[model samples]
Target: MKRDRSGHFLMAQNARVLYVPTTKVASSTARLLLAEANGTYRPERLRWTDAPNISVDQGIHNLEVSGLQYFEFLPETQRDHILKSSNWWRVGLLRDPYARLYSVWENRVLLRAPSPWLKNFQHKCSEVLIDGRLDYAASFRKFVNVLRAEPEIFGDDPHFKSQRTHLGGDQVAFTHLFRVDKPGELDIFATQLGQRVGMKIEPRRLNEGLGLKHLDVMDAQTASVVEQIYEDDFDAYGFERVSFPSISPIALASVGETKAINYARDVTARLVQLSQLARYRQRSRYLLAQILRNSGLRRHKKHR
Candidate 1:
């Protein structure tokens, strides 16, 4: 479940832009790219000292530094201004719901890096933890059950929440929107967005390593259930249901070898998660310094 991920939003005042983030749709990569464009992103990935949160350096973050603020974390005054910004570019992204859930399963259960609320969710679902790991195959149906049955429980977690709602639902405030499943649409949006922001944005892949097989785990019943669960996303976003490619049972029926493969896959997933922290740290410090300098000048001019 590429869930709500602490329910964050990104903004870049210098760029006259606001971004509403949805998980498993390349939100992290978008955030970094936006920060770089705003000229305030630090190369180093720092810990969030304010709470038990793993985040980029908060000191050089926010509206002051990066011109980006976490929507849910910001004060109401700031949030209201951004959300209601008609003049600014309000943007959002979406992914196929099935794809998002599969990524979530790989990231949280296999990779062992999850949002804070995910553990509680795991506890409520099936597949008892075995040797500090979840039974990935067993969890999908149960997870979908939870998605349908107790939607309110997933209200805060966008990973599993409807993309329609995360992208502002029927209110539909976004001036620019993109879909991960459609590369051509993404390219068209990126080209136009770059012209508006006065910089080239070559969309880079981020937060991906999982294969397409996540969707195939769905049997007919589960597929129908998920389609219903995310029906809003399908309708609102103009997306169609994905018919995952089915593999023959004989090919996947090797029980002993499958166990080994699952273990290896899980181990690889964990390594990728660990390396991302270092990757975040390597962003250019020039961006952060530029925002600080320009912001200070703006404030000084206002006073004068």
Candidate 2:
């Protein structure tokens, strides 16, 4: 949806942070922080939904364009307004690909759709066997094949040069990019984000929504299978070839609670706004249809 000139400028100036949330990379926690910083933060609405005032026909075309154009969709007057505004910056976080893929699998399992890869993993078994692990090279080969066949499923494109480019467009200049493995890096990132926004943001609950419970308790062989499946992401994101961390049961529970609470809060707010907008659009369309039909009938009567 196209925002008004004033709204667009305000967003560009006050909310320049464009978080390219890649699945399970503490995206919830990052969104929560952004929400607290700006009371009007709507990550889902920005990425998924258009503005309520904007026309659906125009909005669909805007969505089809690349990310760079999407951010500056306002008229020339609005674009100038945003350019003059202060406090504009972009930032995002990344996670270990292998771990993120595992988390994805775990979430799907909870939703009763485990192993989106093989399609039959759900019917096969709740747990995966990982003893007779495939070699990294072989795993990489399979991953490449899948990506080549189904770019949409893997979230890749022919135009994008790299995975990051595919995610955040070529021109988006990020002010900060933190890796999940180095939790401490988040603090530095927060400091920079605070500087840009002109406020101090104490980083807490860094790895919110990520927990061991979500992780499928798999054998070494199964772990290798998943690792192979996500080799490209690993290489792209700079994941070290280290054994997965053993998260204690208590710690896992804490993580789960944090994730649930944060997700509930963020998702609820977004859904409410989306529902209201949808209702408004439906009502507006109904009124327009009625007016158009009456106008047509009036014209026909006059001709007769």
Candidate 3:
């Protein structure tokens, strides 16, 4: 898939660095940081416009990272090649699945600040706004359910896409993948890149939509659903399943007085496993085809 590189990805030939942004993972800061490294960032034009009605009200805006000149724009072919080559320094920002989901629920589902689809999602789910606000927990429950059923819907949106998807999953790899929990790594990355490019770069946090209502009392069923949905994330990043309060194991489900919540969790978990297996099988087939094609071409050239 061709990504919008200007804002979603970053490059610095001087630093020989490429950065892929994972939403809610200090992506705004990384974008500006790389833009500055490439001399395209305009801090003066950066303004915080908070019109609650508009999505841009929450984060930094007006910095056209792509419009500014850069050492290079990383194209799909080039990015794929470079990520696999050790010669080029590749980096990406990743977050803990649990923490990232919490942040998404707080800022995106509850506040509906950036995502256009999310604005009307609550209404579609019969979650009416009370004094211009819907219950965050109820909205988040719906959000998680939808995502579990249709993971493909998240492919285009960075906020909801799996970190593996952004980092090329099993298709391509990065040289240095940093975690959000380990914030000091950002500083380390900045310093390393600065030395490479012969410039000074100071890492700073940007667009942390904090002060929003944080979910401190998540029930067991919701937690189970999240764990199953983000199973890939947990396995890929070596993250442990975080424990949240589960009021009653059996009370999680009762669907109009039908199946138990635990039953739903089991189904979601199995589905996620099957999806992962399918992707892995597909990747294996792709690799085998490439190998065969390359071998045939080599034999033809030898005969010639």
Each candidate structure's TM-score, on Cα atoms with residue i matched to residue i, is 0.64, 0.49, 0.62
What residue runs in model 3 are displaced by over 4 Å at the alpha carbon? Answer: 1-8, 44-63, 66-81, 116-119, 124-139, 149-155, 212-215, 248-304
Clashes of 3: 1
| Candidate number with the higher TM-score (2 or 3) | 3
Give the per-residue lDDT digits (tens) of candidate 2, residues 220-260: 44445555655665566676655543441111223444355
CA lDDT, every model vs. true structure: 0.61, 0.45, 0.59
Q: Who is ahead in TM-score, 1 or 3?
A: 1
Tens digits of per-residue lDDT, candidate 1, 140-180, equal: 66677777787665445556767766676644367777776
By lDDT, the best candidate is 1
lDDT of 1 at 68: 73
Clash count of each predicted structure: 13, 7, 1
Candidate 2 lDDT score at position 259 = 52
**lDDT of candidate 1 at residue 304, scale 0 to 100:** 44
lDDT of 3 by residue, 1-304 (tens): 5634334555655455667667788776666666667665654442322112222322233334222222235466876666666778777877877678768765555444444344335443343233444444555566777778866654455677677766656544668877766748788877776776678998777556534322442566777888888778888888777676666221121233123323443554465455556667778987887887788843333654
Pairwise lDDT winner, candidates 1 and 2 = 1
Better of 2 and 3 by lDDT: 3
Q: Supply the global lDDT for candidate 3.
A: 0.59
